[model samples]
Target: MKLSWSVEKNNQLKAHPDRGICFEDIVAAIDHGGLLDDVAHPNADRYPGQRVLVVFCNGYVYGVPYVQQDDGTLFLKTAFPSRLLKKRYMGGDDNGKKS
Candidate 1:
């Protein structure tokens, strides 16, 4: 899947200096066989064509929220470290075991 984000979005992500997570990291994690799911969100209507996905990278699981453009490009809305999602998807283990 193709992934993309706007310069303004990039700047917004960069604004959070404490986050230490970037678009590049998200892309790389997705490329590394990240798991995709159709989980429901309370604010799902806010983003048209939105998809909720999670990726495990560098021992961390990230929550990636995005919408797909007509050209099949994934326009990333935002990304953040999600320990709750990690535990839910990867099981409640530190070693990433299915359990």
Candidate 2:
């Protein structure tokens, strides 16, 4: 399965590649559909869309794998390692603010 991580996530994993990706198994699930069943429901409609996925770096990490409608392509959108995982990974903030 094809998967990727962001530059920041790459650095974080570089520190400990062994334990860097506890959710590596998620990669397999990417192609098979919710193999890990860890992704939360979507809270908003935005770019990149929300889908269920198993993140390797940590529970804080959120990722989306998609099959391209153009040519039946499938790839990773880069694992996002952030506290944003709690909100379906659309990038927002506290105090009721959306970014």
TM-score of 2: 0.32
TM-score of model 1 vs. true structure: 0.74
- Most TM-score-accurate candidate: 1
Worst lDDT run of 10 residues, candidate 1, spans: 90-99
Name the top lDDT candidate: 1
Model 1: per-residue lDDT, tens digit, 7-80?
A: 78777777876445678877887777765454555376676567767777557777778777889887887777
Q: Looking at candidate 1, what is the lDDT of residue 36?
A: 49
TM-score each candidate.
Answer: 0.74, 0.32
Q: Candidate 2 lDDT, tens digit per residue, 1-32?
A: 43444556545544653333423444543454
Q: What's the true lDDT of residue 1 in model 2?
A: 43
Off by over 4 Å in 2: 1-19, 22-24, 29-61, 65-69, 87-99
Give the backbone clash total of model 1: 0
